[model samples]
Target: MAQQFEDKFRRKFYYLRLSVTDVCNFKCTYCLPDGYKPSGSKNSSFLTLPEIHRVVNAFADCGTSKIRITGGEPTLRKDFTDIIRVIADNSNIQKIATTTNGYRMERGVAEWKEAGLTHINVSVDSLDPRMFHQITGENRFHQVMSGIDRAFEVGYKQVKVNVVLMKDRNHHELPLFLNWIKHRPIQLRFIELMQTGEMDDLFTKHHISGVTIRNQLIANGWILKVRENNDGPAQVFVHPDYQGEIGLIMPYEKNFCDSCNRLRVSALGKLHLCLFGEQGIELRDLMQEDAQEAELISRIQMQLQNKSVSHFLQEGNTGMTPHLASIGG
Candidate 1:
């Protein structure tokens, strides 16, 4: 089943972003649908744990050395810890991380650590309770804050706080959010909300550029000294004398597709070439066929061959659906 395939840049993609579920407990305003209702459909329960392992192992055997677990909220999955352990135990994967909403970390951090989760990224838009509630559409501010504190106490070396920069929504809180890392061990990342998912219509409405953000930070005397991560995205820097670092994930403003080396797997097992991909190869179908490692590797190689260099961020683009939550943002 191993078909010959490769991309233009000669960069062998070996990273897989796997979404565990499309079930999140909280309805964040930016993420939830217009008339939202929680529906963990039998078809939408996402891949079974066994199915997930099969897919991950297939990638690992194909030279995938890094993996990140994401979801509507990956922690919500009952077997999340077990899944983490399985990926961690895989000798081919060097790093294992999860992106979460932070509401559950308070009660699950220790157990998650025991399960071999090495790094964590928490979505924290604002520190103010009222604004936090407005942005996330949930009154779990206290719980989220407590969870983040618990993450620090649990001994996670790289606990990154990801703040999606929304134009007029939480834009004013940037300085305050930056202050959270003044003397803390946690890293902070300011992300430009992409024009994708259900929020695609709001592209022109809420799109905030990275240049504006950098200028604002400089205006407030937050000097940025560039720091680089050879294996990861995000152009990072440190505020002078700051404890950790500040990372700017300017996917819209700056294109890093030339050196891109990652592919995303939807909760349903589709292999997306880019975050804004219109379609993906059905890995679940391949798995159901009882394909061997070499065969699976060939499918991945074929998927990567179709990987485009950059994504179109134009307004009203119906490039993809299932939202960022469904696809593991």
Candidate 2:
């Protein structure tokens, strides 16, 4: 039996968000408003495939069953499918997922599915093409929509669409999103805009509480779904009249970290205990050899002891995270 990855608060982690790279194509207003700028280095400093395999193996040994491959845009990597295959080879990993921008889904999703990708979460901040273009600085709104359709055609039972709910941006389009998902098996997630080191001004101007939407869903007869062990921090709700579901991710909400089950690893191989926590613990050196699995797991467990009971977002503390893309938020 695998060992449980439990923190001091007895929060057992079953999910791992592993970032392969920080190179994104989309220039979202909230995340990469200035677009992705590579560090002044010719060589890509992202973790290698062997390093990723070792990290996943160590996590799997500690009972991590779900691994979400994240990035500034994960699909941009040429070896993305190979990365999926590597994780899928491990019997202990039951689910292999990715959170993407959906730019390559139309052309590359079939190959990704064949490589054993089980779940996909695509960021679609706005349904309006013009608004989408304005928000992301990309004119590929229709292309992304078509990619989602292709995802369904290639055998995805359901797709999760992420929308960062900003006050004056796409908040008024809630009804449109509800209608779109009424006939589709989409889990539309509305994430509250979070305060990051670089986007404090934007967060102040556009941040909206997800409680407004959550209360609306409850009043409209949407029932809350019981969360699974490996589920992320989304509070999902379902309605009898609609085929789709709705999820709310409000990090600023009280006790948000009580059910914490996921940890993040940056592309540089540092383990992050909390998204809004301090600088992460380095794990790359231990990943150099397969024989270091035991030590790797030990270091991970040791770091968990330092994870606080909750994030200090209420205290206006965003920690060391400069931007969401920096650590694959």
Candidate 3:
């Protein structure tokens, strides 16, 4: 294997989050409240299939074992299944995953699994259909729930559900979420609402710390699971009485970035060293041809060295990120 992808702090990266597009159908209140407006760029500007193949190949060669395809909603891309196949073709890659809105899972998950998708995460911010509709600006709550059931029927052992916890929004439904996952094999992840350049007021109004939930879990006998090298930033907890698990993503917590082990690449082929980094390094030029693999890998490694020890979220520095969907947060 090539040299492991490590930053200056010696955090070896084993996972890659690759965005295929920035277009999303749901007008999530925290993400895109007014709905998705096209950036006026041509759709053809997004990374092509061959470009994706080359990028994945380079990462896999550098000892990256997992790839998570993310997006405003990754399923928006017509060639999403082919994207999975491209990553799966890399023998060095041990896991192929995607984070989706579950709108198409009911109809497309079976084929997606056949195409070698090993893991799936669906965003279900609220359990109450009315509240879900209110938060997501869509009335497809039942449709998304049915899609989750279909995913299980199609043979996914466990599906992760992401809830962006907001004050006075879905925060009161924590008990409901816990009970819903009690008998199911779902890992309910409660992500603390983050601030972005465009959503300052929303962030101030809704942002609640994940520490409160963490304390509740500890007092209730939920055991913290030791993280694997390639795991995402969620602090996974399990209970002996329940079949499901809980994961908390608290970006504002102290030492949160000490275990950073992943990197992101935008749909437009810019490498993001940190989700809140100042800028993305352009990798599209090198990705145009297969012969540029060596230079591509070198550029990635060189950029890794400049990665900061931690993000500046606590200091209110969101960097160039106007919103989470832009970098597949």
Candidate 4:
């Protein structure tokens, strides 16, 4: 089925970003606005572990070989370890990974690694503890940093840290942040902030472009070198005289939609063709109705074929649905 995962763009859709839950522990200013209330009830809907297993199996049957479990914060889910085991057990899945905030990582990262999680991508915006508190709305900086150390201690060598670039917020921390990961084995990713989630204000206020970030890094005397040239976005780089690599994800400024070979599955089972697109196929209905495996697989294939060439919002346009925490980056 891996052959079927090939898209019209000549790229293979081996990776599937699966959001297991929408509930998060942080209240980042850009991700969620103040006084924000969800349109749906708190306990309204979420895919159970069995349902997720079925969906993952279906995706595997369609040639998805890599799965990244994400969430509002995947660690917040109690059954995360069990879910990792299920993903690891899948014969078709070549790699199992996660993108987390690392707040609860101190408590569960080691165990999670034991449960078949091959690697982790932790989101750490700023190195300053004070600024970290301001951005994450939680004063657990020391703990999150410790969690990164713990990941390395547990032999999770493929660790990466994602720092979203925001003007006037932590954009100035680029050089400082790079220095922190310059010699380390972990890969440092500097992402350009998008106008997604509740970033209507921040998008207008602190929207920073990826080119701006690269210049800033070079200006600060950090010579970035190119590393892996993977197809899944994120322009990667390494230091001229350093070991660890640096990555830039310019989803807004430099659109990689032409090579976009991936699809997102919201925690609630919505098949989002693009991160900035509102329309999605509701797999929950099929799951609830005990849809057959063949039907489920066919529905996913149809959705993939129906995927847009690029996101409508990628051109600085608007009019997409709000994905909330269920849509992972």
Choose the strongest candidate by lDDT.
2
TM-score of each: 0.89, 0.98, 0.98, 0.90
* Residue 253 CA displacement from its true place in model 3, Å: 0.4
lDDT (10s digit) by residue, model 1, range 101-220: 898899999998998888888888888898888777778888988998898888876689888888888878866766777788777888887766567566668778877877766676
TM-score for predicted model 2 compared with the true structure: 0.98
Superior by TM-score: candidate 3 or candidate 4: 3
Residue 4 shift from truth in candidate 2, angstroms: 1.6
What are the per-residue Cα lDDT tens digits for candidate 2 across 1-329? 45789999999999999999999999999999999998564545998899999999999999999999999999999999999999999999999999999999999999999999999999999999999999999999999999999999999999999999999999999999999999999999999999999999999899999999999999999999999999999999999999999999999888988999999999989999989888889899899999999999999999999999998898899898989998889
**Per-residue lDDT of 1-329 in model 3, one digit per residue for the tens?**
67889998999999999999988999999999998877785643788999999999999999899999999899999999999999899999998999998999999999999999999999999999999999999999999999999999999999999999999999999899999999999999999999988999999999999999999999999999999888999999999999999999999998999999999999999999989987799998899888999999999999999999989899888789988888898
* Model 2 global lDDT (CA atoms, 0 to 1): 0.94
Which prediction has more favorable lDDT, 1 or 3?
A: 3
What is the alpha-carbon lDDT for the whole of candidate 4? 0.76
C-alpha lDDT score of every prediction, in listed order: 0.75, 0.94, 0.93, 0.76
When summed lDDT is taken over every stretch of 10 residues in candidate 3, the lowest stretch is 36-45
lDDT of 4 at 263: 78
Question: Could you tell me the TM-score of candidate 4?
Answer: 0.90
| RMSD (Å) per prediction | 3.0, 1.2, 1.0, 2.8
Candidate 4 stretches with Cα past 4 Å from truth are 6-11, 35-38, 41-43, 216-231, 288-291
